[model samples]
Target: PKDQRKFGYAIVGLGNYALHQILPAFAECRYARLTALVSGDPAKARRIGAEYGIGPGHIYSYENFDSIARDPEVDAVYILLPTALHSAMTVRAFKAGKHVLCETPMATSVGDCQLMLAASKRARKYLMLGYRCHFDPLTLKAVAMLNGGAVGARQVVTTDNSDINVPLSEVAHSWRFDRSLSGGGSLINLGLYGVNGTRYLLDEDPVQVQACILPNKNPLFSSVEDTVAWTLLYKSGAVAHGSSSYTIKDASTFRVLGDKGGLLMDPATSYWANRVSLISGDATQSWGTPQFTLPALNQFSAELDYLAECVARQQPPVRASGQEGLQDMRLITAMYESAHTGQPVNT
Candidate 1:
C-alpha cells in the first residue's frame, strides 16, 4: 500500500460521471485517499465498495448521508451527483465537517452557490470547485503565454463548441431533461463550461454579459435550450463570445486575438487534453498535449489531485472555489436575465 496520506476522501454517487471520471482518477491523485463510497443503491455501494476495497462501515446510503459528517475515517467528500443535487449535497457535506471537493456548476443559481459558500465557512472547511481543465498542461501553457505577452492585449476571444454526438433521445426521459432536475438546460449544463473557460482565458470574471439561446428539433426533449451563444465583457476591455451545444459534434475551441497575434487551442474536449497552436509573427509554435501513458490522468483526476495537495499544503487550487462558482452563477444569472429582457447584463 502507498504510505499514509492526508485528506482522505469519500465519494458520493456512483453514476457515469463518477464511474468514468472520479472513481478511476484516484490513481493519479496525490493528496486525496479514496476512503468510502455512497450511493442510493446498496448493491452498487457494496459492489463498488468491495471492488475499491472500501470498508463496509464507510459504505453509506442516500438516507444516511448526514451521518457521514460524523465518520472519523473521511476527511473530505466528493459530490458526484446530478448537476441539480450539487447545492444541497455540498451544503450538507460542508456542514458535516468534511473538506469538500465539489464538482462544477456549483449550483444553478448564485443564491444556492452563496449558501454553499456560507456552509463551507461555517464548517471551517476548504471548499474547492472541481475545474481540472485549468490545470491541464496545455491550458497551463496557454496561461503562461498569456502572461508572457504572446497573446498581447487579448482583444477578442471567439469560442465555438458543439457536440452533436450527445443525442437528446438518450437523456430525454432522464433528469437531465427535467427543467427542475437539470436546471436551465444546455445553457446551464453545457454552456457553463464555456463560461468557466472564459474566466480562465481572460484571467478575469466577466463584468457584463449578453446572450441568446436556441433549441434544436428534439420534441421529446424538454423545452430547455439545446444551444446558446453569449458575449461577455471583461474589465480589461476584452470581449469574449462563446457558445456550447450538445445537439452537434464536439467542435470545441478557444481563440484569443491580441493587438499582436492570436493564440489558438482547438479541438479541446472534456475527455482529452487541449490541442494547442500558438500563431505569432510568421511562424506558429506548437506543443503536444500530454497523452497519459501509464496513469491516464483525466481532468477529473487532475482536479482531485490538486484538491488533495491544496488541502494538505493549505494552498489554493488553480481555478475558482465554491464562492467563485457563485460568481459564475451571478454572471450567468445576469446573462439569462439579459437574454430575457433584451438588455446587457451588468455583473
Candidate 2:
C-alpha cells in the first residue's frame, strides 16, 4: 500500500530456468520483488519456497495458477513454462488480472501469439517476450550503430552457430523434442534469434523469408532441426542472410554488413554485448568495449526490470513485444513449410 504503483511478480514453473535465472536476479532488481512462486511438485516447490522465504499463502500450484489474480501480493506473473504451455498459462494469467512476462518463441504458432496479444490488450496489461539478448549492452549499441550509419544501410545480418551438443541422458521430450510441445523444432526454438536479429540489426521487418532446414543426423536432435540457413529480404531492397547450426563450437555471433562498412560482434556478449568491432577499410575501431567490467548482469534481470518499469509507466518494452514475437513465429512457420516442401518461403 505504501507504493502507489504495482511492483510485484509471481513466477509460474519453478524449473531450471526459474531457479537458475529469475529468482536469483530478483534481488538485484530495484523496482520489483519476487513475491510469489508456483510449481507442480510439492517437494521442489516447498524447497524453493523455503529458500525464498515464501510461505503457504504466497505459494501456488498448477491447479491454482489462475487464482493468483485475486492474490494481492502479485501484480504480474513471469511464465517460464514450456513453449506449448506458455499460451494457456499466459491466457489464464491475463484473465486472472495479471500482467504476464512470457518466455519466448512466445508460442508455437502465430494464432496463439495473436491470442496472447489480444488478451493483453483486453486486460490492459503488457506482454513482454523474454528476448533477453535484445537488451544486451553491446547489442543496444550495435543497433544504434546500424541506425546511426556506423554501418551505412545495413545489407545483411547473421545470428548463428549455437553449439547444441546434449547427451542422450540430457535429452527429454521435455517439450523441446515434441513438435506439439515446442511448436516446431530447432527452427522455431533457435532460429527465431536470426529472424528477430535481422529486424534489430537493421530496424526493418522482413518482407520475405527464404530458408532451408536439415535434420540432426547425430540422433541428438532428429525430431528438431540440426541446421538452418535463411535469407530475410527487407522492403528497402536489402537482404539479411543468416545461418544457425546447433552443433558448432560456441560459434555464436552476429555480423552486420552495409554499403559503407561492416561490424563484427564478439561471440561472448550476445546477452550483454561488451566487445564490438567496426571495420570500414582495413583498420578497426572498438566502441563501448568493456575491460574487466564488473560481474555482468543476467540479461533476463535487465529485461524484467525494464518490463517492471514499463508496467509501472503503462508502456511497452524497448525490445521484442508480443507483436514482434508473433512476427518471428510467422517467419519460422514459413521456414518450416518451405523446408518440407522445398520452396522459397515468402512472408
Candidate 3:
C-alpha cells in the first residue's frame, strides 16, 4: 500500500528542525516518503540519506539541486532553508517540476512571495506552506468550535509567543541572527504564531495593523528587534492583539473573547501539550487534547500526509496554501510599516 502512494518528497536543508523534526516524521507518514535529500553540505546529505534508506543518486548538493528534476523518485520538494532562501528555493523547486512545501512566512518580502506564487502557476505545481500547527489536534478542535458558533460572535483575541534568543556569539554560525537572512527578529520568528493563529481562530483577516517595536539596546540585537507588539483590527469590528519577545522565557498562549462566550488556551501554539478551556455565562468547561486518528505527537507527519493527499487527489490544501502564507507575510510587512511610522497601516 505504501508503494502505491503518488508523492515522494526530497527534503532540502539539514538544519536542526529538518534533522530532528521533519526527517523523523517521514517514518509516520502514510502517503509521503523520503526519497531524496538536498543540502549545501554533500557529506551531511549523503549521511542522512543513507540513514533514511535513500541511495547515493538521491542525494543532491545545493549546486546540483536542479538535477532532482530528472530524478523520478522525487515528486515534491520540502524546503527548510532560512527565511532569505525560501523564495529562491521554492521557485527553483517549482521550475524543477516538483510540488513544493516550504516552511512558513513564505519569503522575506511580499514581492518574493508573489514571485513564488507566480512560479508555481507557471510550473502548474502545488505550493503549500509548512504551518504544522494547522494540523495540531487542539488547533483543529478550537477552529471547529469557533466555526460552529460555540464561542458565539467573536469580539477580541490576544496572543503572546516568546522564547529567549540564543547568545549572539553562538548564533553567528546560523542565519537566524542576521538581518538579511532572518528578515526580522522576534515578530517573524515567534509572533507569526499569534498572527496566523488569530486569523485562523477568527476565520477573518485584519483590515488594519498598528504596531510597536521594542528594540533591545543590547549589541546582540543591533540588527533586529528583540521584542515587538501589534494590534489587528478586523473588518467585522473585532480586534486582536499580539506580542513576541526574545528576551523572555517560553510563554505561548492565546485567548478568544466573544459576546456569548470565550475560549482560553495556554501553550496554544506549542508543538505539543496545550491546555484549552471554554467560558460561557457562569460555567467553565475544560476541553483537553482532542483525539486524532494520527499519533498525538505527529503533527509534522500529519501535515506531510495531508499534502500528499492533496497532490494525489489534485485538490488544493485549504489551510496551508501558498496564498495563506502570503497573507501572513503581507500582514507582517504592514506591522513593520506601522511600527516605523507610529501609525496604523491598512492592509
Question: Residue 235 CA error for candidate 2 (Å)?
Answer: 2.5
Each prediction's Cα lDDT score?
0.76, 0.77, 0.87
- List runs of model 2 lying over 4 Å from the truth: 1-6, 165-169, 272-274, 283-295
Q: After superposition, how far is residue 223 of candidate 3 from its true place, in Å?
A: 0.4
lDDT of 1: 0.76
Return the top candidate by TM-score: 3
lDDT of 2 by residue, 141-216 (tens): 7777778899787877766756544544576636677667877665677667767777778888887777787655
TM-score of 2: 0.91
Q: List the candidates' TM-scores in order.
A: 0.91, 0.91, 0.94
Displacement of residue 79 (Cα, Å) in model 1 is 0.5
The residue pairs that clash in candidate 3, if any, are: none
lDDT digits (tens) for residues 20-75 of candidate 1: 77888787666666898889999888888888899789998878998997788898
